[model samples]
Structure formats: structure tokens, C-alpha cells
Target: MTSGLQQKNSILILDFGSQYTQLIARRVRENKVYSTIVSHKITAEEIKKQAPKGLIFSGGPASVYDEKSPKCDKGIFKLGIPILGICYGQQLIAQYFGGKVRRTREREFGRQELFIDDHADFFSGLPGNITCWMSHGDYVSSLPKGFVSIAHTLSTPNAAFASRDRKVFGVQFHPEVVHTARGSEIISNFLYRICRCRPSWEMGAFIKDTVSHIRQLVGKDSVVCGLSGGVDSSVAAVLIHRAIGRQLRCIFVDNGLVRNREPEEIKTIFRANLHMNLDFVNAQNRFLKRLKGVTDPEVKRKTIGDEFIKVFEEEAKKIRRVKYLAQGTLYPDVIESVSATGSPSAKIKTHHNVGGLPEKMNLKLIEPLRELFKDEVRELAKQLGLPQEIIHRQPFPGPGLAIRIVGEVTPERLQVLRDADDIFVGEIRKAGLYNEVWQSFCVLLCIKSVGVMGDERTYENVIALRCVSSSDGMTADWVKLEPALLGKVSSRIINEVKGVNRVVYDISSKPPSTIEWE
Candidate 1:
């Protein structure tokens, strides 16, 4: 039996520090097949125990030729499980099999025309000449024994290769990326045709399994969850309550940094609707006092995290016998919060939920949704019979608008930001563009500019509108709002948000700029 919750016929993806590893998992889930991302250091015994239908190696930033490149157990190949390697994963396989791989003088990092051949069924039903997205610097120079080229690019002749007899496949170009035309179909071929996996991964089954797992992990212990009215925490609280009814207690903290009327809405949804054991904490002054004059993003996160732990600990004292703390910590949060599997991509930001708690808190953590993504959480929330409002709310930081304020956090600044953000989001919903984008919010910049308000020279804060389209929070692109919508939002912000005179839109993408300005 698998030690973890890896179900039958699921695909196990080994992460080699790839930024797109989570994307690969997301693509697999989109096909209705379960996918789990494990560390590359997983042992052969572990793979055999998991008994997954197939395995996929995620493309990583590391070069396989390097001495410190990540690796996996070689003996798993003998397990006869079908394997698909992408980019660095392909190079790792080629090198292990005595194939030649050399760094090209010119790095390949963009779109290329990939020509298919009749050697393998991986490209079956796809066009002979297909467009692919390539982002690897190294290429396989020679084929391994019994492996034949299935596809070729102008620069990368061994763009794709497979050993049909051994049920092994490798693709130089990322088939998981949407930029690659028919990329999803190519992956489907490997999944259905080669691995013989059925669409067994569904939200209904996931909720059941998670409920059972939570009941077992937290037996007879009182579990306390910090419910923020967001889909993640709300879903988590509901899920846990189902598992251990009445044993779970949800705490809704009025941290003073949340949006206008957010606490009231959260109260209505969870306390009134769900009928769960809910505690409302008024720690507005506590949080505001600590956050005064804090400018550095990291320090601000730490300060909030520290304060959160202190508050939770105090709450637990009143609740009595609270032994577990359930958080809505998702996979992307864990990935971005720290170096995942010692990847080259180290800590991006310290998410308050993941890094907020003290090392030795009285209540242990039980993050039932820690391994899931935002979209998956929404799916589960919908299946759990949650309202559309909870399922489709924009992603809010654990630190709330504190990170969005971009400077010293104060009550005066917080109120101004709350008004502006509320207007931006309300208008987005009114325009019917709310569901079109992954996240849309307003960031209050500390800087001020002189402006003429009815012929009077006034200096006021600027609110930057950030709207991005993304499958997960991993990589995001700016949403190009129509000029009319922008004009409406800008005009409303300048006129309505009292302290704000200027409204600007953020057009930067994730790599160069994160979703949040801070």
C-alpha cells in the first residue's frame, strides 16, 4: 500500500526543481487524471509501493550534466511503469542511458516548428508540422539503445524520442505548456494510449478521501481553523467539520487589514450559513499597533505572522483542548514560501499562512488542502455545495491588504485602500469581467502626486489596479481591461476613494513582476 494517499491509476510526477512542475500537475488534472508531484529523491521502493500507472519527470532549471543536478532512483525504470520526460527530464533520461547530450552555442528558448514522424504514437492524430514551446539550453546529441526519434525541430533533431518496447518517452519541448499547439492532446496520447490511465481523479472522490484522512489524522482532538471567508479556508473549515463534526472550531479574526465589510460577510457565510462552531476575535488594535511604521515586505509579513500566532494561541486558551490548527495552505503557497525540494528557485515570499506560525505552537497543523491548487480548491468547493460567491472570490493574501498597501501600514491608509479596492473589485464584478480573470485587486502605493481636483492643487495617494489571468498563482499575465472599463475604474477611484487622486493599471507579468506589487 502507498504510504501517502496516492490512489490507483494516478500519475506520479517527480519534481526536479522545475518552475513548470505544478503546471504539469495542473494539466494532468485538467484531463481528469490524478497527478502527484513528489521529490526527485523518491526511492525505487517508494515508487513500487505507490504503484502508479505512469510517471512523469518535470522540466527543471538545472542542467543534468552539472555535478549538483537533482536525480531520482534509477532502479524504478525496471519497474516497467510508463515514463514521460520533458526537457531537463528528457536530458536526464538520455544521460542515464548512455546517450550524448551537449550544450548548444545558441540557447533555444522560444517557439519552434516541430515536425513529427511515424516512429511513435505520441504525436498520433497531430499535424506533422506543429508549433512547440522550447525553453531548454541543452539537447540530446545521440539516441539511446532501442530509442527512435519521433519528432524533430529545425535546431533540435531529437526533439522527441520514445522506446515503445520499454514504454519510455521523452520530449525536448514542453507539451504541458499551452503555447505548444495541441499540447494537451499530445499529453493525452501518452496518458490514455501509452499509460492506459482512466479519468479517475474527481473532486467528489477527493473530498471523500480527504474527509476520511482528516478524521484519522485528527482523532478526538479539537481542530481550530482560521476561516477568512476565502474559498481556501472556508472550504477547509467545511471539509474538516464534515470529518469530525463539532470537534472543529473556526476562528474569524478581525485583523484590521481586511477589506471593507469583509468580516461581516465572512460572519454571514460561515457562522450563519454553515452553522459551525465559530469564534469572532476583535484583534484590530492588536494588529494595527504592531504593523505601525513597517515598510519592508518581509518584515511586515514576519510581524503579522508573529502577531497571528500570539492571537491564535490566546484564542486556543479560551477554546480549551484545541490540539490542531487547520490552515488552507495550498501547494503554490508552500512552493513560493520556501525552496521546494531544494530547487534553484528559492523563497519568493513568506506567505503568512505557511510561515506565520511559531515553530512550537500548542496546536499542531492539519492542512488538508496543502497539496492542492487554487482551481482545484474551487472545484472541490463547488462539489461541496458552497455558494458561487465563495467559489469565485479573488485570491486575497493571508496578510490581507497589508501587502497591497506597499508601505507603512496605518489605520488611515488602510481605510483609503479599503475604499479603493472595494470600488475596483465591485466594478469588475459589475462589468462581468470578475470571473474572466484569476485575480483583480487594487494596490495602494504610499507615494503621492500633485493633482488638480476642481482647479485646486491636491496631493493624494495613487491606487494601482492589478488584474492577471492565471491557472494557478505560479505564473500570471496581466489582464488587458478595455479602455472604457479602465476609464470608469480610474474615474471612480479618483472621485470616490477620498485619499486617492491617481489610479494606474499594472501591466507587468509575473516573472518580471509578481501579482502583488509589494
Candidate 2:
């Protein structure tokens, strides 16, 4: 049974392999309306069963003219519900409605000015011209029979089009991205004016509903949570505890892959302070033994996931009457780990918790926050009266420092990276910039560099610092740290961290590079 999320006021997003598909759902949720993602190959019969208030077609990298590009069922348009298409999605709408979409000489890849011709129906209350984010090579040369060009950019003559009578709309530029001016307003007009959806979804209501659902799901069975002391796990533990008080037990595993002194600190925060039924497992040797010589990221993740299950299975057997295993799995973990059926979305990386779906397990899995984003989990934490330290803590991956190191998992490499990362985080916190960025850490690059120390040339490991700022993990931009702060961090890591000679800063964004090195 699903929670109260699949309701009448929710929006359904058809995923066509766009990297920004999750962003579209986040935007709709920000409007306080629920949104879900499904494969574009889903039929109209399947769509009718969900009874979505509106449908949104996400932009993809493929062109509609390609022989093998992904496409949705054409019969979905007959449902008579409002639909909006963005970027490549617009190409499909144009091609299906008797319009011509042809390749342009040059692709528009950034912000452009869109001149609005009519602001009555689709482009309501907007001014003459507005800046919009454009990233497409194809343009609609001609409009459909009933569709009108509501807005146009210099490069794309039909930037935005609408068919009021058919309750269909298409925009060549992306409104979900912040690069476009008044992008949220454009989405708001579509959600309220076009779809007539209510702004009724909120975190408080979710907590109330989830607690009850968890109680019903786990009647008298004891539940075990793998607590990492991060916001997601903390929120999940607290929610489960509220449902079945003493029946919930949290296990904090010291896999020797976490930050320096993290295991003890987590124990202090949870066991000593919160006073929940907790277990501390020191399985560092078990994890390291299995992860030795594993270089491939997927292999490392799956190995760690397998080890975690084995450890949990042993621990659950000790805790009598336990039948449910819970973890802090979020939406991004599920999205990036698994691909939709018949969708072109690529699997970026495998999260240890989500990558290995339940296998050889006697206990059933329960994830309360699987449908929520990182920021949404933080909000849920605050609503649950969690302390600021827990609610505002930076995100940490389940694979931990294994993913931070570019190569094999060894005690020496882990220590070197840990020392460098400790210095980086310490400086950021001392400068009062710790909370300003989404995530800030140090990576131990696989290659080494030659440097001079005490009048002698020596080769040592190079440490790379990655820091990004973002509202959500979907899209990210590197944080422009101060020069003095960078200099201090570099000097401290070189002096304090053994085997690290030089420190470099990574300035790449999410599209070209991920936050982690591995």
C-alpha cells in the first residue's frame, strides 16, 4: 500500500531520459502539489488509472527525428488533461501535431530573451520579453493547426506554444531551471491556471500520514534502522520510533569508511543524548577485507552493500523478534540507482542502500522517506523537532570515503584522505562557511605529484577539494570560496595530512562532473 502521495491533486511526469526530469518534479512539489515520475513508454490506459491532474513531459538529450529516440504513447493526449512539454519534449509535441521540427544551424545552449506575443492564456501576466534558459538544436519551423506561438526567441521562432482549446502546451526553453528568469512563475501559472491543482501538500501532513502508515505496516514486529547519523537516517529513525516506540532499534556501523571520529560522534548524538535503543557494531575489518583491491565504483558499492546486508543480517538475528529493516533511502538514491522501464535515463551511480534491492534477507524493507528529496528530508527533520546540528549536517554518501578515494580501499589511503578531509571541513567550519555550501570534502586523486618539502623534491598524493552550492542535489554549481580560505586549507592539509603534498580545487558543475571523485 502507498502513502497518501498518489492523490487527485498530484501531477505525473513522463520521464524521457532527461537529466533534469527530477528537477521538474521538485518544482511541482515546491508548488505544494505532489508529482511522480514514470517511464514515457507507459500507455494511455495506464495513465488513466493513476488519474493525474496534469501531465508533464520532461526534456531529454535525444531528438524526435532520430530513428530510435524515446517517445510516449500518442493516445495520452486524448485524456483531455492539461499537458506541458519542455525542450526535446516540445519537439515530440510539434512532430505529433502536424508541425515541422528541423535541425538548426547552431544550438542555443544558454539564457536567451523570449518575446511574448500574447500574455492572455498561457503566458499570462508576463511582460514583453523575458530571459529563458534554452538548450536545444531543433526548432519548430511551423506551428500545429490549432497551436499558436505565445513566445519566441531570436534563434527559436516558436519558443513557447499553446493550444487553449485542447488544453495542451509546449515550451522550447526549460522553466524548471533557475537560469530562466521568473521560471517558477511560469510553472505556477501552468499548475494553477491550466491544471487547477490545489496547493495542499506539506511536510506536516506527510509526517502525520507516514507515522500512521508505518504503524499499520509494522504492527508488532520489531524494526531495525541502519543509522548513519545523517539527516535522512535521523528523520527516518525518529518517524519510525514515533510509530513503534521501543520496538525500533538503531544500529550504527563503524565500517572504517566514514569521516574521522564520525562513528563516535554519531554514538554521542544518538545513544547518549536521544536515548533510543541503539547498537554499535565495529565491522571495519569485515568491510575492508571485502573492499580490498576493488577499483571500479560499482563493484565497490555493490561489495559494500553486500557486506552491510551480511552484518545487518547477523545483528538482526541477535535482536529477537525483529522482522523489518529500515534505512534512510531518499528519492535521488532511487532515481540515480535504478533506470525506468523502456526509458533512456542512464544510471549515474549505485548507492549502497538502494543499489542492492533486498536479497537473501529474512526481514522486509521499510523506507519512509524514499519519495522525498534531500531538502524535503531536512524540512521533515525540523518538523520532528530534531536539533539544528542534525538537520543542517551536510550530506554523506552511504559508501562513505571509499567513493571519495579514486582507487583501491586500503587503511593507508583511507587515513590520508581522512586527514586531508578533516582539515578541509575544519577550515570551512571555522570560517563560518560550513553551512553555506551543499557539500564540501577532500578527494584523494589516484595520481601523485612531485613537490619540494624542506629543500628536497618528493612525490606525494594530491588532494582535490570539491565544494558546491545547490538548493537540491539534482543540479549543482561549484561554490566560489574565498582565496584566503582556500590558501589556508591548502597549507593546513599539506602540513598536517601525511603523504599529501598538494591540494587542488575542483570547479566543475554537475552536468560535466559529479560531486564525488569516484
Candidate 3:
């Protein structure tokens, strides 16, 4: 969704390059109130134009005293909106209001206990002591001019401060993270009790509004949607079809890089079950040819993305009068592409549909799910009456198996990884862990090792198994699969799939490592 279509009475979250900034937006949106994220550099006049009922300052990695640290316009405090500061945001508030802030000798990270001092509305209906997730090195040394300390921790004497009359609040801990127990409740208290925002936003409303918007935008023009048979694309195709039935046409490209039999399965499901106006393109040869000797991850992604676009362009020409191109670009894609918050976020890998899409394409872009998270898209899929299989299917990247293959994109490597991934997922489903994990896949590492098979010497490539548990794709932790299940998967892959000898599970989290290997 575009910034123009954001609902009124929304909360404006000023991002300061925090990794958890998106989580803050997710929490607010979960309360049924619309929320938008912008850079901390957003001026007061710009924020005033949005007319948000509340303002939130997100945590960041930079220190307030740093030379290049991000800061907000001081006039925002005069907007008369309820303002809540978190972590670095809390430091900004303190530093802005004549309070002292410095690097603490004792740093607070991970889970910590917070003791409430004077009960305030911000912590209403909560216990006196609660566990909170803390990730800050700097602490507020003194309270702001008109602020009173409302909570404290052993390390941070002023863990939370508030000025009820000014409608300003600051918390040293991150309530947006799940590690912070009662995190959602804290956000709800702020949304409902302080800001007085109405819980009026829902997926049903979004569908109705988006359909009307799409209808008005593409009155008589036909649109072509890129369908990957994943939840995001499928939902977008259905939603757009609902908007303009005959005007929407979906193109599913088999880029020779998907899982085994994925192309055939997708064709069957779309043609028979969903009954969509679909066209399937088998451009595997073209894709594999273009990626013949490519080894760089970014180069591989761009090559696949460009090839997909070319295929879509060719298909669009066959169809008559297609004026728009639709994609299932989600919020995480937008955030990672280039900070939606406008703050300086280190670019993670470039998603094929996000930054890899050609900017000079002939058709105008339509991304209905741009402002939504993955879970929200699933809910929308359910509202659209999509089949259970399509609704619950785990997310697959647009680059398909191209990214999953670590070093090179080859037919042999693709087949090997696909076979191994299928077995991995089949076992996950068999163990009743498929739906429990956010994403689970196997990557074919380029390196080879010596092994013993049938008492003889054998050399083959190693396969890495990656499974993560996450609320949104933004942040994730490795899923702790049972030892028996791991043993079964490893045994099955080593014995069944031909080129692999070793199986290793990745235990890294999202902060240091992304879900994808390449």
C-alpha cells in the first residue's frame, strides 16, 4: 500500500536504524490500528501532515553522542501527540529534554528484570516487576526536566520515565520484542489507553479498500501478475482477480531452479483448484544458460530476476493490452531493500522481487501486499477463500532454488538440492514440524569432502540444513529439531539424495546471519 492510503488515526514510528524497528511497527499494527514507519529525520511539518495520533521512536545501534547519530526534529515534541521512546529513542528524549545520558559501565542485554516505581498508565494492569528484553549500552543518568522516573532496574535506575501531562513516555527496554513478556500488552496499553486509537483496521477492511483502489486505478486496463505459487503471490493474484476478474492474468515462470516437480504441482493447483486465468512458462533452459558460470550471490540473484522479467515481458506481449505488473512485495522486502524508515539500515541480501526487479519495465507496478507482513498475507489468503495448501505453504524466495544453491546454479546441483530439500520437508511434515517452523530448506554447499561408502573412498558435496522459527521473516532463531528427527533427516538425505555426505544444522540467529545462506 502507498503512503497516501494509510488510515487516519495512525501511529507514526520514527526509525533510527534499529534492527527491531519493523517489529515495533508489527506490534502496533497487530492492535488493529494503522502504523507507518519513517526516518528519524522526518520533519515536524511532515509528521503533522500525516496527522498521526501517536508517535514512537524506535531503538537503534548508534549512540546519541555519536557524531553521525540520527536525531528527530525537536518540534515533534510540540505536536501534542502521545510519544513513546524506546532504547536509543529513550536516550534521544532524555538528551533532548536536558537529561544526562552516558555509556554505562554495566551494559544491559537480553532478558532483565524491571521494577516499577510509581505505577503509571503506561504500565497499567501490569505487575510491579516484569521481565523485559534490553539491548542498550547507554542509560539515562538523570530524568528530563518535567519527567518523573516510573520504573528502574538494578543497572538502569531510570528504566522508564513519563510526563503524563505532556503525554510523553520513555522505556529503556524493548517491549516490541517477544522476549519482553507482556510486550504486546504494553503496546496495547499505549495504543488504546494513551493514544485512544480505535481498533478498526482488519484484513477484511484491507481487502475491500484495496479492491476498490485497484478497480479505480485499473479501470479498463489489463494487469499481469507474477505468480510463484507461494503464499504471497497466490494471495496477490486472488485479490487482484477479485478486483478485476477478466482483466487479471497470472504468469508462473518455471526458471529451472525450483524444487523437484514444483512447476507441475503449481500448474495443477492453479488450473484445477483455484481456476485462475494463468499462463505457465518453462524458461528453465534460458535461466540455466544465463547462469552458466555465475558464482557471485548478488550476480546470480540479478541474473535470475532479469531473466524472470524478460519472460514476463515476452508473455505480456502475447496477452492483449496489459498495462500493469503486480508482485507480492511484502514489508520485509521493502525494509531490507532500502530502509522504508528512510534511516540507514545495512542492506541485507537483495530480494529478487524487491530491488532486483527491473525499474525500466514497460508496465506500471502494483504491489498490494507491500505494506503487509508475511503472517498478514496468510490471513488475507484465508479471507480470499484460498485452499489450505496454498494458505499454509512456507514462503519461497522469488529467485527460487538459485539462491539456495550456494556457489553455482547448475542442473546437477539444482536437482541434488531439490531432491534433498523435498526429503527434508517431507520429513518435517511427517514429524509434524512443517507448520511449526517459519522456513526450512537445505542448501547445497559448493565445497566437497571425502567420505566412505561401502568400505570404499567417495567424495561428494556437503548439504546444510537450515530451519528457523520466527514470527515475521524479519527476525528468526534456529529451530531446535529433536535429535531423532535430525537423525532421520540426515540419514534419509545421505542415503537417498546422491551427491551429499554431510548434514549440518545452522544455529545462527538473524542478527548475525540471514535465513538464506547466499
Best by TM-score: 3
**Tens-place lDDT digits, model 1, residues 30-149:** 888888888898888998988898999988888888999888899978899999999999999898888989997798987899999863578878877989989988999999998999
Per-model clash counts, in order, read 0, 0, 0
Q: Please give, for residues 1-518, the per-residue lDDT of candidate 3 as tens digits.
A: 43334457689999998878888989998998888788899999998888888999999889999989998999999889899999999999999989999998877777899998876578888999999988988999988789999989888898999989989899999999888888899899999989999886788778988999999999999999999989999999999999999899999888888888788888888888878898988888999999999999999888888888899899999888899999999998877776876697777778888878887988889999998999999999989999888888998988888888888788999989999999999999998888889999999888999999899888998999999998998878899989999999999999998988888888998866888888
Candidate 2 ranges with C-alpha deviation above 4 Å: 1-6, 340-342, 357-359
Q: What's each prediction's TM-score?
A: 0.95, 0.95, 0.96
Q: Over the stretch 77-141, how does candidate 2's per-residue lDDT look in tens digits?
A: 89998999998888899899999999989977878998999897567888899999888888888
Model 2, residue pairs in steric clash? none
Candidate 2 TM-score versus the reference: 0.95
**Whole-model Cα lDDT of every candidate shown, in order:** 0.87, 0.88, 0.89
Q: Residue 147 in candidate 1 has what lDDT? A: 91
Model 1 RMSD vs true structure = 2.1
